[model samples]
Target: MAIQRILAEETVSVTEMRKHPTDFFTDHPIAILNKNQTAGYMVGKELFETMVDLIRQLQPQESFTATFQPSVTHLKAVTKGSAEFLVKANKEELGDFVE
Candidate 1:
């Protein structure tokens, strides 16, 4: 199945739970897991920015990898001319979402 189709199905399941509160309660564990996953997707941008800011402040000497979507704009903003972190784009890892 396509990634978009899989995401849409997950979204539909969540929406069904919201429409039926009793079902949400019955499937509370699944709901919680779904909520956590959704929350990550919602805060992805903010999370990335905060992580980059913290890394900058700490200025760790060790090299690390921060993987993100193959978009250059935010990566450039975070690692532009930075000797500590190097931003690399792997288009093959982008899947079908790449433009």
Candidate 2:
């Protein structure tokens, strides 16, 4: 038998999820299971967006430029001499597109 980690506080079987999809979502992350094994997570829209924002913040500043500013586009350092310019964006206005 193999042990698996459950990342979410709630667990929902695939069968139950299929039977009632909306019942599983409650603005919190839920672990989706298949045959007692972990399959994936059922995350609400708000939670998903929050996760994305956290990921962006956790990214190494020296490695790559941040991608949030409208005027400044951040690109990956492709070549040895490739460079990146970062423009500050309002962290409060996450999940919103730039004008």
Candidate 3:
């Protein structure tokens, strides 16, 4: 059998999680193991959100030009470069559907 390496500081088995699902939430990520193999890491909702925010902060920001669609359902914005992104319509633009 090959040796499995786990990078997490804490490890929990699937059986334990099934026994007590709420017991595993922590400020740090926990590595979930299956059959003594690394499966995935689980983190608290707040921690996961913070990680996502940190990732977004690390990415370079780009200047973009906004263009609204006639139907108000979609808005496409193009960066100063060749990149393009789609933004959801605002509440007012989306009208009663959002509220």
Point to the candidate with the largest lDDT.
2
Q: lDDT for each of the candidates?
A: 0.45, 0.76, 0.73
**lDDT tens string, model 1, 12-72?**
2444555764543321123222533442122234555776789787876686667767678
RMSD of each: 15.3, 14.1, 13.3
Candidate 3 C-alpha lDDT tens digits along 1-99: 877777779999988878987778778889898888888888888898999888778777883435844543332323422232114556575567622
Residue 24 error, candidate 3, Å: 0.8
Residue 82 in model 1: lDDT: 51
Alpha carbon deviation, residue 87, candidate 1 (Å) = 37
Task: Write one digit per residue (lDDT tens) for candidate 2, span 1-99.
Answer: 778999989999999999988877668889999999989988877888998889889988776755765432333333322322113435563346544
Ranking by lDDT: 2, 3, 1
The TM-score values for the models, in the order shown, are 0.21, 0.57, 0.56
lDDT for predicted candidate 2 compared with the true structure: 0.76
